[model samples]
Target chain A: MTEEIIIAGFGGQGVLSMGKILAYSGIMQDQEVSWMPSYGPEMRGGTANVTVILSDERISSPYLKIVDTAIILNQQSMDKFEESVKPGGVLIYDPNGITAHPTRTDIKIYQIEGTKLASEMGNKKIFNMIILGGYLKVKPVVKLENVIEGLKKSISERYHNLIPLNVEAITMGMNNIVPYKIEKHVFQN
Target chain B: MSELKLMKGNEALAEAAIRAGVDGYFGYPITPQTEIIEYLMTERPELRTGMVVLQAESEIAAINMVYGAASTGKKAMTSSSSPGISLKLEGISYLAGAELPAVIVNVVRGGPGLGTIQPSQADYFQSVKGGGHGDYKLYVLAPASVQEMADFVEDAFDIAFKYLAPVLILSDGLIGQMMEKVILKPQKPRMTNEELIEKNGSWATTGKKGRERNIITSLDLQSEKMEARVHRLMKKYEQMEKEDLRFEKINCDDAEYLIVAYGSSARISQKAVELARAKGIKLGLLRPITLFPFPKQALFELADQVKGILSVELNAGQMVEDVRLSVEFKVPVEHFGRTGGIIHTPEEILEALEQKIIKNGSIRHHKTRKSSIL
Candidate 1:
């Protein structure tokens, strides 16, 4: 199976890192993967995004015009990538800080309060892990054990102690995802 | 030991150089490729293999330092973007004239002069047509993947040392920055001093004590002697064309239309070929692994099979001239590209092929594109 995806959000919210984790997980499973980031000034403070492709076969182009899924975290990303998701594909996003919600009927939409949940968990750094968890709940493209293994490989040994905490956030995100029902007022938290 | 790791192109090349037992690396930092030097600094290849990594004061200094290291038949390399590469052209010419084997990497950016920090293939003419001020040719290798980025290091050095020529890895910001899974090979120890003297003793500046001091100079006061030196260099390049030329063909058995590209453009055109095949179009892709060699013979043969050809590059149609020349205008040849750092998409490339080659219904015809922004 092949999954082409784009992860977009603010620069410091770990958008590129999330894509990197997915790439590492794919490689651990003996699959081909590529992670192409928006380099230069856009990566400093502007909206940062990465296009990641994982496939059973050799991948041809790292630059992509279409994707199977778009994990959007911010409103600007929601505006930008909502149309990039293919028909019958998935678009997952956090409802927090979003002014206008995704209204596409052709693609699957799911929401998780990643920012709020991270705040409630007393560590905002796990926000991306929660989003990754939510994406895994919908697609389950990568095994959780491999994701954890990939996480260990991505971060340094100093953060090994926090693996279990990040696992908790992931599990929380996986269990808390709700399919969008077109209800606008239900997710203002 | 071998390792399977995910790395950017620049990072993989640096690690591969260390694993290849490179003697020294001298380079100035530039965007999309600073990671080459940065990774070298952070990984501390010096500790593991005694390889020296230094940040030179400028691009010119870095190249001169590379020239010095190469004079002793040591494996030395330097990397930079476009404008910085321009600064090293004089030294590159010297390396060619003196017949030194050193690796020079240009992770090309959009440019006439510092045009953009993004990936571009605009340097095709400069790379293959001798960017330096001379009649010498560099063995230019264009890597399309991070794996090739890692793998071509040894190949470049081998080719360089074999012919006593300079080898250039003509990469772009795209490959330099993108991350992919690459299988790194096992480390090989560097050639010992005795081995170097034995292999390159006749030409290399080994020492003055043993034999009549081997004079190394590109300049000969006698015009006839200079002519002989140039002819000798020319024969080596011709040998490279006969022995080391490389290219790849994809889905060409029944192809009626062909796309010729290299580097990042090759990867993108591969995708476009697949997309067109899905729609029942018989399109194939020809990727030149070596830019300097040009793959002219392969293109000449393919020209007979395919009805038309499209040359897709990242610049304003530079390789198009070479493509037309290779085919001798036997079939229609067109160019589709986006300049100033904007990568042309597969859809646009396919559209160009249809409009310029197939739909136009001519063996050779020209029509100026009405819209340039698509």
Candidate 2:
């Protein structure tokens, strides 16, 4: 299956990190994957986004205009990507930050309180994992176990203590998700 | 035998150059490409190979140093960004005129001037179309990843020596900065003065012996000899075009549309292929591993099969000209790119393909076929 995902938010919102974690997990599962980030001046306070493509065949490009799924962590990201998601694509957003709702009825969306849930778990940094966890629950693209392994390998030696909380946040986020179906739009040939 | 380790494109190139037995590295500091000299400095690979590593005062001086080292029959290399490379063009043209063997790595950044320190493939025309003056061509290798970045060094050096011409490794900041697993080969030194003399001691300037005084010069006072020299260079270039054309093709046999791109742009175009496939469009990618010996024949062969061609690049439309030249206005050649350090996303490329290739499929068949002759 072709899974084109974009993880976007402010610089410190862990958008790029979440994209990397997912890409790393895809690599571990032996899936052809590519992780490309938005660079140049746009990377400063601007929205940082990464397009992660995981497929069974070789990935040619890591860029995407219309993503199959988008994980938006802030209002800016939601506003930026609302029109770009495919007609039947899924959007997972942080309800506390993403104030704008999508206009399309065919698309599936999950409004997650990732920051609040991670804060309740006693850490603000685990918010990305919480979002990732919500993403995992719906897509089930990569195994949760593989993602955990990928996270352990990615974290630095100085921040190894944060691993447990992040994993806990992921499990918490996954458990809180409610499944919904996306209507498939048919295009006439 | 060697082991694979994670390496950035710039670092891998440095390591590979050392293994290929480069005589010296003369370069100035530039973003993205800085890691190349840094790798040589940190790893001290030069010390192991008895190679000289000099961080020059400027890109101009570094290229001049390359010219000098190459003149001595030493395998020298230099690297810089787009602006920095622009500074070195005069020196590069001189090296080309002198028929010297050197490797110049342009870790491209956006430009015309002091552009941002971000990855870009905008120097396509400057690289392939004689960046400086005079009718000359430098063998250019466009690598798409860290692996090819390393692998191309040996081939680049070999081609340079074989043709007695300068070679360029055209990569962008992403290839320089991004990390990936790479395999390191054992060091293989280029032919020595003694070896060269033994092979063709009569021609090289290993201090002329009891024989006639030896002079190595690109200039000849006699116009007839100068014209002959030009013809010889042209003959060499033609031979190179025939022998050294390298490219990577995806499912082009059944492809309705083809994406023609090189280096980092090619990698991004690969993603566009899948996006198109999912949308039920039969697309393929033609990635050029060698930029200069433009694979005219390959694209010409596919002209009848593929409906249209998408020339994806980091610049506005540098390689687009070459694509047009190859196809000869046969297929509808459209361009999709980002400039001034703005990298084109896969989605943008997909949109362009949708508009130009998929929607305009009929246009490809309606257009007159370009000539196959080179």
Candidate 2 docking class: acceptable
Residue B21, model 1: lDDT of 85
iRMSD in angstroms, per model: 0.8, 3.1
Where is model 1 chain B poorest over a 10-residue stretch in terms of lDDT?
Answer: B363-372
- Model 2 off-target regions past 4 Å? A42-46, A95-98, A101-105, A111-134, A143-189, B1-15, B18-23, B32-54, B115-120, B173-225, B255-258, B271-284, B304-310, B328-374
- For every candidate, the chain B TM-score is 0.96, 0.94
Q: Write down the RMSD of all candidates, one decimal each.
A: 4.0, 5.9
TM-score for candidate 2, residues paired by index: 0.80
Model 1 residue B273 CA deviation (Å) reads 1.3
Model 2: number of backbone collisions: 8
User: How far in Å is the alpha carbon of B310 misplaced in model 1?
Assistant: 1.0
